[model samples]
Target: MKSGEGRVCQNPWLNQGHTVEFSPDGKRLLVGSSGFDAVFEFDTDSGEVVWEWFAWDHGFDRSKLGHYVVRSEAKCKALEAMGHEVLLVDDPGKYEFGIPTRQKPAHLNSASYDSEGRILVTLFHQGAGYVVDRKTGDAQEVISGLINPHKLSRRKRGGYFISDTRRGKLIFIDENYRRTSEIALAGTPGIERSPQLSEYLQNTTELREELFACIDIHRSSLWLIDVKRRSYRGIKFPVEWSVHDVASLGRQHGLRIRGLVGTQFGKVAAFARQLKIIHHFSVDGCEVTALVLDSQDRQRQLDV
Candidate 1:
């Protein structure tokens, strides 16, 4: 395979690709650009542009459901004095963005296609997740009240696994969208192995009370990515990746790990390391395009 030589998309707004995934049939590639509100589709083998879906083009309402009742004008003035902007909008009507037809902006973080081919997406700012039927373009809420849900993975069974970055917990929801189980980083395998690691996790209790970073579920094992520790562990796989976000290469094949660690300058450095390979690569300005494994040892690309 040619290293560092591939077809590149020259679109400026689409330059920084955040995440990518292959369709189940391996015919198309889905790309998610975090900085923008669109997901791109491309041909898998030929790297040809297919179509782009813009979230803003859809009519989905992206407002929080609730109302702030102000008992008196003095209390409202006190809130305004604290530099907090208050909007006196009610539910349902709150979704309008000053215009009659335009919908409010939703900051979409990650998205995935479910078994029925419907697209499910996570909205960070709204703390809610939605499922959009690709055939009808109708998006409906699936879950809500999540604190910074970042990565989403489909389970082999029938549900979904959501990564709550802010709360540091891996939430497993059933098909009915009810939270089934939540795994914290305190008593897991990786932290249990080292005493120092356990102490650090205990210290975080004064701050947040729980240490959950990232999580991935394989066949029968559960892998955890610890943002606080800047490490990856097969909490159930019995192996460790250098980072987190473990994407399996194939059945019995090793895993690909990606993680972020804060540097001295207070910026996060993104690192990618393969499980079998000892050396890892530091992503400069580029984020992970996609991590997919074929039946053979070769890996494919779905991002620029």
Candidate 2:
């Protein structure tokens, strides 16, 4: 795939549109922006905003102030112990708001589409996850107590699992809404765990246990973990300029298409992380909002 290939959702109040998901129908993209506290659907071919599904903003529901925007006080306490600021843990307005000092809206960090055509976003800093209504565009809290939720992954067996970046825990939720704490393979003995989390993904095999993850640190890297073998290896994915968000090519796809979501001004694009590059960000001059299409043809390749 070439640079500046399949790209869209270019600059329109996308301060923290860090997370992007392919539409269920594979014709659009759902971009979740923390800067705007909303998820807007963008036409893949046109790159035009179709509509937005806003996350709960400050004073969203005065009737139930803390309903949709709840946080894990315990998790916040842990992050505070980890050297995060007190105001950042409890009164999070300062994180986003600089002036009036109102509460910060739910920052939609990651997004996924359910079988019912609804978008599920990890409300990271908000300590919860919300499921958006396909028709009304409104959202309701479905998972809470998640500390700085980052990635939302659907399981092959029953339910779903989410990554808590701050706490370093992977929580599992069943179809019946039962929650259980889980440790990613990296946390186990002999397996290396990268600091500063970004995304977690498990392959859709019979066991549904092999995992893939990426670190959002300065020298960002990627990992492939085989739980059954109890072994893992790290790939030195070199990049000069920093990066923030990553989207996975489905497990079924033999092409390990991992797209880099360029924020803070750069091009959005996708490629296999295992590929080595001897180039710098200046080579492209930061053309944000372009990446490889998980095109139907590629999906067909995976299916074959």
Candidate 3:
């Protein structure tokens, strides 16, 4: 709530959390914890786990998943016996930095509920989408052969939309998991989105105006678009680093941008308007530190 202060709800199952969203009733928090290879629902008021769906519980084999589950107390002890560092499974930061990159099989990037009250998730490493029964935890692979898919959202009209990052395509699929259409990403040109990019600049209702924002990491630029007018304005930043994500701290505070020079060092900038830079800060390396608008509509750094 205060500067540099946050509420920490520590849970062993909340490891490497990728996507978190509130249920339609706004009482349950659904999270797709990639490291655990599972999706979970937690009670918002009590912080109690309502349900969890593990990939292995639904036909997946332990040999095919990430070893993050092994970070439990007993397993960590065994790993320490082998001269490995002991990082608790409850500490996602350790699993993120201490573990190897190969520990991902059902690398879930997004999770949401469909109209039928079923769970839909996109597995980046598996390049597939799965439909899971909310009550039974029974899952079936609905779609596959995608190139590093992310962001699964149910369409208002019908079907769903998912971002195929590696292929630079926004694929639309029917209820039966058949491809209906695909849109090639434009504006950024040859610059492709990365699976490592957890936060994305997309459409939101917070803005007072009907405008869309797109960031060009390669050029260090931001494009403000007005679809109704078919016009856009490009604002360039003074930094050479790649801007990963942006957050709006209301109209009075302007936009905040988060970027990294490389793997270790990170940077954040505040822009008032156009090309005007108001503030900048340097950050220590983390797996992913995102600029987000908090409950009071204030800017805050969230590590995921």
> What overall lDDT goes with each candidate model?
0.47, 0.51, 0.57
True-structure lDDT of candidate 3 = 0.57
Please report the candidate that would top lDDT against the real structure: 3
Candidate 3: C-alpha RMSD after superposition: 11.1
Per-residue alpha-carbon lDDT of candidate 3 for residues 64-84, written as tens digits (9 for 90 to 100): 432333435776677668776
| Candidate 2 local lDDT, 25-78, one digit each (tens) | 667877766654657778877888876665543223111123223234664466
Instruction: Write the residue-wise lDDT of candidate 1 on 68-161 in tens digits.
Output: 2232456447657877544332232332212111122444656666777777776655667777777766678877886656646565556766
Compute the lDDT for candidate 2. Answer: 0.51
Regions more than 4 Å wrong, model 2: 1-7, 57-103, 156-158, 184-209, 216-221, 228-230, 236-241, 248-304
Clashes found in each candidate (C-alpha, N, C closer than 3 A): 1, 7, 0
TM-score of each: 0.51, 0.56, 0.58
Worst 10 contiguous positions by lDDT, candidate 2: 295-304
Error of 1 at 288 (Å): 20
Write down the TM-score for model 1. Answer: 0.51
Which residue pairs in candidate 2 collide?
266-287, 266-288, 267-287, 267-288, 268-289, 268-290, 269-291
